[model samples]
Target: MMKRFKTAAALMTAGAMVLSMAACGSSSKPAETAQTTEAAASSAAETGKAEATEAKKEDGAKFKIGVLQLVQHPALDKANEGFVKALDDAGLSYEIDQQNASGDQSACQTIASGLVANQNDLILAIATPAAQAVAGQTSDIPILVTAVTDPEDAGLVEDNKKPGTNVSGTSDLTPVKEQIDLLRRVLPEAKTVGVMYSSAESNSVLQAALAKEACEANGLTYLDVTVSNSNEISDVVNSLVGKVDAIYCPTDNMIAAGMATVSMVANENRIPVICGEEGMVDAGGLATYGIDYYQLGYMTGKQAVEILRDGKNVSEMPIGYLDQEKCALKVNEETAKSLGLDPAAVK
Candidate 1:
């Protein structure tokens, strides 16, 4: 009986030992599964962090540009288009706030004040008056001027080689001699050249002076028919009809705005007009020998990019000219026909 009792006890002890070993093995497996789940969750969290970092990099890469154009004329419009294209080429997104002054100097000043208040990254001034307004409003903001005849005359810059101020941009002034030569080429018999421009416009005055010098060199007589405002355009144009053989239109914003009226009167009197910009040619002027306004805007856009992205000083950057290769002769067939002039004769 004693031996049987001892055997039963030993059997109970072995069974308990086996059960304990099985419980420990099962607990070990659950602990390993828990560790694996924690590791996967940690890896997923790290991946999320990396994606968020990349998204931030993408979100931080953009810029802002503000454009102040004098009017909606073709030359200034083309320059604005060129500026947009330049920004697009650089893969930078920009917010452009464009304002047209409708040929009002006070309106330009008001718009420029608002832009400066907004703290725009850069300002693009399309004409002489517009550039002057922006420069007067803010010295901290860089101003890029286009379609402006002479920055110096406009008082936007000290010199072309060294801007010496916060303003710099492309000049629309092509060689004055080339323009005079073009006039003579198109109208070989025209001895007396009549010029109508806004006397208030400094750019117009500078162009008039240059045109006068050019005409003198070519043995062509020049007559000044200056007008101070839009109201005087018709009178100025009518006054020059019989006295002058041909009319020369400078890149005066006021004159450009009133081109349709000027064209109607000039064409009625059988006078052919040679303008400084392609827009005037399109507006009923006979022809133009000038730089592409859009190309000038694009050139200015590049300078703006440098000032914004490359940390370059605007005062240090020399004013740049648009590539002259972009300059060309644009003639109007309808105007030529109406004036009894041949288009092919001008080129």
Candidate 2:
């Protein structure tokens, strides 16, 4: 009986040892599982934080704009100023990368290509050739043109009402027909009108054609004196000084640049001169019936605001014209007097 008791006691002790070992193994398994879960949670949290940081950086990014000007002139300078001011008023910050082509078409293309390669958000082309260069570079990037006489004639778009492409802006065109009438009103006895322009300028070509037609309608004779560069302006003006009753100067950039020379010659010869813009009149022209450049620039700024803030597509926005409030008839008193005329009569 004693031997049997001893064997039973031994069996009980073995059973207790087995239960203790099993409990230890179970506790160790739970610790290992907790460590694995913690590692996975830490990895997920780090990935989420990285994604949030990337999103914030994207939201805070500023827009970049590229400005390409054909040449630096007073009229174009005003337009550029207006554009920058309008963007500033909209409360949107931007970086303006301005480039001048120096009146070279190839230089314009190069500037445009560089702007495109940098991925500018928008492009403001200041003239016809600059606009054409941008259009040739990209169809996806939005382009806005200023100081362009006829967008259709420049081939920037098919129509002014509906650009039908990724291009639209303000036209610097004034009423050529009305300007002709004003010349007649100011100088009734003047029978022949001489038009001087740069032959290479598309705007000049278009304006000269319109002037010819208007002169024909008014029973006035028209003469065209074309100069290929600034060097020839003086000779051209001298050539036409005595031939015509009065000289008409359009908003030709080359002619506008050399206004002092043209004015000095015209003023000396006692030949009256009519111009297409106010700046020219201020320079030495007898009178001009056209839009105010500052006002036009301001108008262009407002259009840019619509494009940037209102999320309006540039292609859908028709080219805008300055209101009559922006148009005026300005005359140079000194120039009129030199021609033995009265400014009060036209005013």
In terms of lDDT, the best-performing candidate is 1
- Tens digit per residue, CA lDDT, model 2, 41-156: 88886466345434533575466689998887777778888888877777765678989997777899999999999877678998777888999998867788888888888888
Deviation of model 1 at 257, angstroms: 1.5
- Which residue segments of model 2 deviate by more than 4 Å? 1-60, 324-326
TM-score per candidate = 0.81, 0.79
lDDT of 1 by residue, 204-256 (tens): 88888888988999899989889888988898888886799998888888888
Off by over 4 Å in 1: 1-61
Per-model CA lDDT versus the true structure? 0.84, 0.82
